[model samples]
Structure formats: structure tokens, C-alpha cells
Target: MDKNILGNNVITQIGILVHDIEKTSQAYADFFGIDKPDWSMTDTADIAQTEYRKQPTQARVKLAFFDMGSLQLELIEPDHNPSTWREYLNEHGEGPHHIAFVINGMKGKVAMMERNQMPLLQKGEYTGGRYAYMDTFNDLKIILELLEND
Candidate 1:
């Protein structure tokens, strides 16, 4: 097992891959009885390609972030073309995609993973966080993340 002490800013976020962002966003909003979280958009294919992961054959995605108490829930849907999430939905439907664990000392952690031959599947900086993805059990299904303190 891997062992590392996460910094105080560490936050845990869950990612839900969905077919409809609005529907999923509403569900969470209604459940929480709070205003829907904000939205974010990006074309992550470039980064995926660099990591040798499946290239997203989509234009972009409409992603919404929902705050649930302390954790943030991310809902993703392809706004154009198709994506890995879309494919996952086509095959399995909406469900949990991954869990993001925010942390500090990211570079140090990443280096350790590398020295142990468990280099991240993908790594990059975004939204005040340095993010890295590592698959659970060598399976590409679940992504384990290390997010920098933000």
C-alpha cells in the first residue's frame, strides 16, 4: 500500500460521469436544496494524448461542480462530439468515475510514486491545483488522484 501524509488543505472531491449535466446537477442541487454549483469547460484530449490515454474524440465537455457540505461533486457531460465519459455512459450509464484527493507536496509525492514505478497515468496543473491520476489495480476504470493544496 502507498503511504503519504496529506497536507492540511487536502480536500476530497468525487467525480460523477454523466450523460446529462443539467439533470445530474439538478438532482444534487435539489438534494442539497442549495444553488447549483458553478460550471467549467475544457478539452482534455491534448493532455490525454500526452499521457497515452484514450484521446477524447469530442469538442469539449460541460462540467458542473456541486458543493456538498465540505466535498465537491463534479458532474461531467460531453457538450460536443463524444468522450470517454460518454462512452462509459453508453456502456454502463451514469455513475462514479473517480475520487480526487486534494493534497500538498504534490511533486514530492509524484516523485515517490515514480521511484516506486507507479507513475501517474496523467499529471497537470489546473484551477490552483496540481493534479495527477493513477489507476487502481492497473485498471483504467477507477482513477486515484493527488490534488495539490488550493
Candidate 2:
């Protein structure tokens, strides 16, 4: 198998696209015997800077983060916008959407992935961090997310 752009194989998060954040989060919590995940909506100001298919576009999602030991489980509910989460839900239904790796040089790693034929799908910033999703489903059978915490 090919090594990742960062030369590390650690997956920090597994993201799931869902139609309803509350329902899916509860199901995951019950299944894993954990407390309900905390929910947050993407800020409107940040949505303006989001990019989809390499163009600045508007997208919003409701997110729920569940801490599971060393990894995090993220539930995403697309909020009436064209985004990676919505595309996944439309094409594949609700399930695993992406596997994310936290890296140091996020821009360099993202460029490497793009050079390797994994074009960027979407990107946005959040508190203390930013992320980019790559279209690597054909090769890896799942989207790959690159995260950088500042």
C-alpha cells in the first residue's frame, strides 16, 4: 500500500455523514457505551471561506464529536448546502465518510495528495485548526481528511 503524504498512517478521526446528528450520535453513543457527543454548527463567518471543488463556496454542517479513546468519531449533518458531507449522503447514504490524519505541514501534505491524483473536495477552518478533504475514494475507498491544529 502507498504511504500517506505525511508518511504517517495514524488515523485520528472517522467521520460519518448523517441525515440527523442527534439520532446518529445517540446511536453511536449507545453502541459504544459512551456519553452523547457534543454538537456544534459550523459558524456562518467560516462558511464564507469554505472551498468546494477548488472554488470558494458556501456550506454548513452540524457536527458532533465523540471521543473514543485515542480516536474521535465525528458525525456530520449537511445543512442545505453543497458540500462533501452532502455529496456523500446523496451518493452513498449514511455511513463512514472519511478517515482523517492530523499532520504538521498540512498545506504540503495536501499538495502531495493532490499530486498523487487525490484532488481536494472541500476545506474549511474551525477553532484552533483547519482541515481539507481529498477525493481519494477511488484509491482508498474512503475520503481522506488532512487536519492541522494551530
- Top candidate on TM-score is 2
In candidate 2, which residue ranges exceed 4 Å CA deviation?
1-4, 45-48
The backbone clash count of each candidate, in order, is: 0, 0
Clashing pairs in 2: none
TM-scores, all models, native as reference? 0.68, 0.92
Error of 1 at 15 (Å): 0.8
User: What TM-score does structure 2 among the candidates reach?
Assistant: 0.92
Off by over 4 Å in 1: 5-11, 43-60, 79-91, 114-119, 137-141
Please, what are the lDDT tens digits per residue for candidate 2 over residues 63-148?
Answer: 99988889988888987777888888998999999999988887888888888888899988887888999999888899999889
